[model samples]
Target: MALTSKDFKYVSYLWDDAKAASLQGDEVALLLYRSNLLGADLRLTNYGGGNTSCKTTEKDPLTGTDVRVMYIKGSGGDLGTLKRNGLAGLYLDRLHALKKIYRGLEHEDEMVALFNHCIYDLDSKAPSIDTPLHAFLPFNHVDHLHPDAAIAIAASKDGKQINEALFEGQIGWVDWQRPGFDLGLKLQACLEESPGIKGILLGGHGLFTWGDTAYESYVNTLEVIEKYSAYLHENFGKKKPVFGGVKMQSLAPEKRKEQAAALAPVLRGFCSSYTRMVGHFTDDERVLEFINSKEVARLAKMGTSCPDHFLRTKICPLVLDLSPDAALNDSQALKEKLQPAFDGYREYYRQYYEDHKHPNSPGMRDPNPVIILYPGVGMFAFAKNKQTARVAAEFYTNAINVMKGAEAVSEYVSLPLQEAFDIEYWLLEEAKLQRMPKPKPLSGKVALVTGSGGGIGKAVAEKLAGEGACVVVTDINDERLKETAEEFTKAFSRDGFITAHLDVTRGDTIESCLKEAILAFGGVDIIVNNAGLSISKTLENTTLKDWDLLQDVLVKGQFLVSRAAVTVIKKQGLDGDIVNIVSKNALVSGPNNVGYGAAKAAQLHMSRLMAAELGGDHIRVNVVNPDAVIQGSNIWAGGWAEGRAKAYGISVEELPAYYAKRTLLHETILPEDIANAVFVFTGGLLSKSTGNVLNVDGGVAAAFVR
Candidate 1:
């Protein structure tokens, strides 16, 4: 009753390799097929999560002799959302040679500069952060992905049992390690040790199987996954593909786009999945089947892709069905379904590690699923890069195959709860986490900009709000704030914009503004304390009366507002960020405005202390100093600049230009310019870096730079 390779079913699709390239023997036709196939996988995952590589030893355009250029899935692509140009050409020689570097690169920073060398298409956001994996594979056709069916298996309690049952002696298992040439080296060793090993399984991850031909690799993948599905079905006593529920069909691309445009915002907040239209394929077949199928539909009632898919996909999919409106109910249901699966997965690792580990043994890896599926929606897999997606899918397929087979014979066993926790919190996955490419993790996050009506504060807010953040513009000047909000509205849309009249100098107003923000979206994730005012005068010219006004706005105002935010943030336990807009006068001495500089300086140091104190809450605090943010700022254009210019015996127009051009890095400072600096401070990666000062001047401060 043991399962064999013959148990799986598949068909191979092929194109003539000789006709793949151009008339120059480039094999364009075959390459096109690989790209098409790769796109197909993206519909299954996200094309950015999978990889397609074409190796040609033919003469390069420059060398005019035998050379291999490996095209990898570049960063910023979603496999199901990829375009033709998404394939990035990597210098095959450089990649192959890099495969030989043995100096223990256990760091992603070390390889960041190195990968920049072989990148293709100057416009290709960045090479697939996983080129090294594709470079080292020794096969003609290598398609790696995190398939939905497979990730569910990999993340399950039954993964090891399933993989072993399906591949038996034919697959190579590699514990979760950071993927790169090192992983490549491990694969090579495993291949050598097991001469007949057909593919490699990256445990707690996804899939990678290759063949001498594209058709062979594709067929093996198809067959292996089918085998995996069978394994899941048999073990769970799952019936045949449930088809009697709904018979939904594809909507026109236009309709899909319209629906996606309307729904993407709500969906991202709900499922945290990428539903963009970037890949070559869309989710017509899968979506229709998922919604209509009785078996898969039952899964919607059950909840999530679970332990298998989380590695490539996340825990759930955002459903667009207006009728269900079930996230409020289903979210709790998902946690319920996840509990048993999680409990079982943990015990499996505890048993294996306790029995097999030695003092020198590597630590247990994560047991959480990389991808999750929604029956009426689609499957999603989360990976560090495209290559990770590839191995993850393969691992997923192997897990599914064996889980199904074992269930055919008897009930499948799952890992224990405690053991699964140990793996989920393991150091091995932590190592891999360090090697992941830096992304704008704040991408598509909405940032509400306070005091965005003008000046450095407005600039800082706009910058953070510009980089994919749904900007909610606020200012004491309702007219100005509305104007700022309208500029963005004209460019993006109403969904991307919001406006509120705010006076950050008041705690009650700040609190009400934030409440309104949460009502509009879900919660405010970023805060740019860019709302402040400066009163100008010499030390001798200044009065205690004017100083109090400056302190109230610069020092007390920021404190009162951020304090209110901390209350909500601490309760939510979210990674909320707070960026204070300070000035270079805080860092260096400022002319004439003695009270202004002192207030700014006090706020700057206060930012540092807040960073240290609130770090436990995972809230980040950073400061930005725009040496000169132009004269048209509210402070200048509001007649404050004219009086100050007269006091200095300089033309009002000359003062701001002097400040702007005086910086060592002589570049004019714009509001959007200052906003860019604020973005880096509040966005991801700076998670560990808080309590910092960023000079937005064109090198005027000369502090951090040179």
Candidate 2:
């Protein structure tokens, strides 16, 4: 059949007949294709929120005969990026046979372990908890999606009645039941009772649709969601004002962002009280509309209705009590109110865990809210990493859409507190958490590396990111910045780091770069002042311009960047590190290096001074001195190598060997070597030590710290 050739008001129709036809014979491939298409659209399903399955005939290794196999999305895998290996293939017969031994709802979790025996492929990924939901359904192809429009209908107070009326009984309605063996049975019973029903609306949950063919299943899922979206929009339009109308106007775009940036580090600090958390901020129109609305407090308290929504966002978001305008106008007052707000959220969350948690439940996870809503400013979502934080924000945004749609048509209804608690602390969910890999040492840290477009700065950024810190790679060279960003994207994925063009000598640029870092990953926790240029000349040859330029780039640049970042660091109230990349010349005092050496000496002393002053704030300031980081060094590229070679009476090629020979260890220092020294100072290895200098010059006695 021709794919739905029509315009969709909410979601895009991306089904291509040619693409579907290409995978016609491969049932699993078709399922993956369908899943990808659906998952690509946020309006259809959220990240890692839904699952799809297709039954295929595969040869059995034991019997050497054909057997029916169900391939479904694996646990914790996202459909949009699903690959062939990400699908778990289970023997359909074995899955069906396990039902005979199913004791009841109480023992449903046991069935999850038993699923291992049903694996069709030994190399298959772990099956999702929703496996039974797909296995028990009689259709050859099935799709279980958490589409916002469908979820809005399902989360409505009269969800069952609305489902019956909206689809004219074509789609059956099942009251709220946490997904597991029992819910699967309920789906089977619903279908058994009404074999003509096309889909099912799971109350306070999502929608389930199926078909005889993969394409048909894909189309059916879209059609159901589209109908609901159109219906909801029509009703939403009819209402004079949504979400009880806006309670207050949004701060202007710039002001809103400014407010968000100011609040992010403080909020992040609160969220990270127990364990460090990375934060993501959003000022999207939908978020602004919900938070600025009259019913925001009540609806936020009610929490999210969709299981997928709350799973990432927590039971509910903590709404900031302060007004946006007030937050923007008075920074000090905003900070005062924020502390109490966070304290209250923690107490409430602690009580929630105590009130509902079973003795066997995994000890309460972090008591901090994953999501925080600021009226007129925006929303902040915190998680252990940047991507997770960003995804959590996206999920909450989806929740907002779901709430809006539900409120427009019928009063929105969240899951009962008990039900919500059970799902949040589910043993199976706890097991999934246990399965996650241990976080890297620098996981929640954010670093801003100036001059990171190349050389020591790039190496330091890369090293920090490898250890799990989100990095902001800033440099004045636009071309190199782009290259570094692209390279980092390949190495660490897009979320690992952000690139900003920053001329460190310029105060405005320094402020802009710090603001970018704050907005990108909440705030900077580690500062690498590596941006610099060198001028090697005797006192006579070194003109006033030469002396001034060296000082501006080396000394003043570090001062501006550090001063700006300290403002953010103080707001976070977290221990911070500033690693200034000074040089051996600062201590050695060689000929023709007067201008460069003076600047390096100034930078070294400045770091010591900052360490003494900022010690009260727990912000450590240190220095990394490198003799000659010639390889991949932009400083060396700009005639410094030639000048140094001339001074040493050798060619530029001999500089590395000469420097290495001079060191007691006879080792040539690379940019990565400098990067490692910086990490040692900032990576909690020397947490108690501050105002110290680490020389990465392979043991230059003259450069050794006294």
Candidate 3:
């Protein structure tokens, strides 16, 4: 893609005049706009890999004097979604003084304190480590990024030579250096050597582009990247890069998903050392093709594509075999297969840390791997939180892109082990790690909910997601399922939920949906059999079709889903939970509802049988019986509420109040009430209470346990 002047004008244009006027009053708004435009383009930067800054004038907090300020992206903020708060403003003169005297600050901690003290506003966030680099540069606007195409050229064996040939006198070059006060000095030195350079490429690091305006800096970065991409295409014939020579037989999408599901929990257990982690799997074409190469393990273990990526993905990925036979292995056998690999990786990391650490350096980081490569199945990114795991995954994905692009031209090279260590354990990043939030109770667990399009099922799935569990949602209704999945993801602020079109009555559909759930979250730790249908009719008036419909879905559907889940949990060897959403009608019969009542009774009995059979395997099965839940429920839709009202000789609109008044507490139940009951049972809060029935019917005497 070529850079154009039109792109600059578009960033300058604002949708709302008042809002644009407000932004124009503050220079940081233009910095944010250009930063977001650049960050939004995946080719430019990803995750938290980039920072942007602008030099402007703001009133001093202590005095009314108009002081020059430098607004830079703060540490740990994603540039694509950056807001005003994400920018850290510092008094320009103070930063300039620090640039001159920073050499006297021997410790990284001292430099951090100096940056904090120079804050233009006492309440502003801490500036990024690259703040000094932005301060020392003479340009009004600066943008620094580890763009894939730019990094590809920067990490090549002949990268410096290639850079010199491409831009000649207009671009400067700086070799790899630890990003702190010293790096700022090196950048200033490089600029003095080659004056008027439009951009600079940092060997083994990333790219820096700056100009008088944010638009000029943004376009220059794009122009440089576009040239590198064109060079790769010129030599590599525009083909998607992959690992060379290794190959795997392609399986149908359904089969591939099933295999990925079976492999997720095993990898999760094998990779974790102290705390459990969530796993996200990907089989994008490039990832598959690259891992399929014979050199996949060797190249993947070489080093990270960008030096800063070492903090997110570690020095290298943990490579595994997830071929068909490997995926089918039992827990004991799987552990045996993975133990040596884990041991080797840990030993390698320890030795690297020991060889590189200077006196007073931070202790060695956890030896566990963040990225995992499985040739046939693709890659897995593991983290304590789903969002962080995804960030790790995306960076690795970009790593492959750069490495492949570099290899197409020449050998793909990475920084030495010692350099990776310095970047990974930098004090600034260590501080951010200390500020991480406490993990949720179900942080690393995954759940599958059937009929999640509406009612109790949707409520249950959303509740689990809110509690930090990755949820797999399914429903026969496509539109409702999509809406539910969107709501779940937005509420949780993570991409940990997946939706599938599933009809519980069909074995094939049930099987495929289970695979989708497994691929999404690695494995299923909990399964809620909440899909249901009811036929309200007297036994004499009930037709065979109505009976079969209720029986097939209510009874047989739960059996199919439970059986499949048990097979996976047994392979995982982790304790699991299964909750069946039965009805209050199962405990007390209702007039003209023989089919619905009988089907629910059968399902309840089946839960008991499952509990008894799976007890030895540490898998618990429980039942939740709920009644008269009308709010946010689809069960009462399709005229069932009217039919029940007719039977009770009351208006349909009044039925909810009638049921509420009949309850012991005189309160109407909502779908969330049933969701809470299901959560209590599945969360191991009732760990020893298997083969038990919990009621969420607002205290019905007939439904109360004897």
Query: Could you estimate the TM-score for every candidate?
Result: 0.44, 0.98, 0.90
Candidate number with greatest TM-score = 2
lDDT by residue (tens digit), candidate 1, 267-340: 22322222211101123453445544543333332323323333333222222234222243233444453455
Cα error, residue 556 of model 1, in Å, equals: 11
Residue 475 in candidate 1, Cα distance off native in Å? 7.7
lDDT of residue 656 for candidate 2: 86
TM-score computed on alpha carbons, candidate 2: 0.98
Model 2: how far residue 564 lies from native, Å: 1.1
lDDT of 2 by residue, 232-340 (tens): 9889847757999879999899988888787788888888888888888899999999999999999999998888888899989998887676634344666677778
Write out the backbone clash pairs for model 2.
Answer: none
Candidate 1 RMSD computed on C-alpha atoms after optimal superposition onto the true structure: 13.2
lDDT of 2: 0.89
List candidate 1 stretches off by more than 4 Å.
Answer: 1-25, 28-37, 47-361, 364-526, 532-564, 573-628, 631-650, 657-706
For all candidates in order, the CA lDDT equals 0.57, 0.89, 0.80
lDDT, model 3, position 299: 82
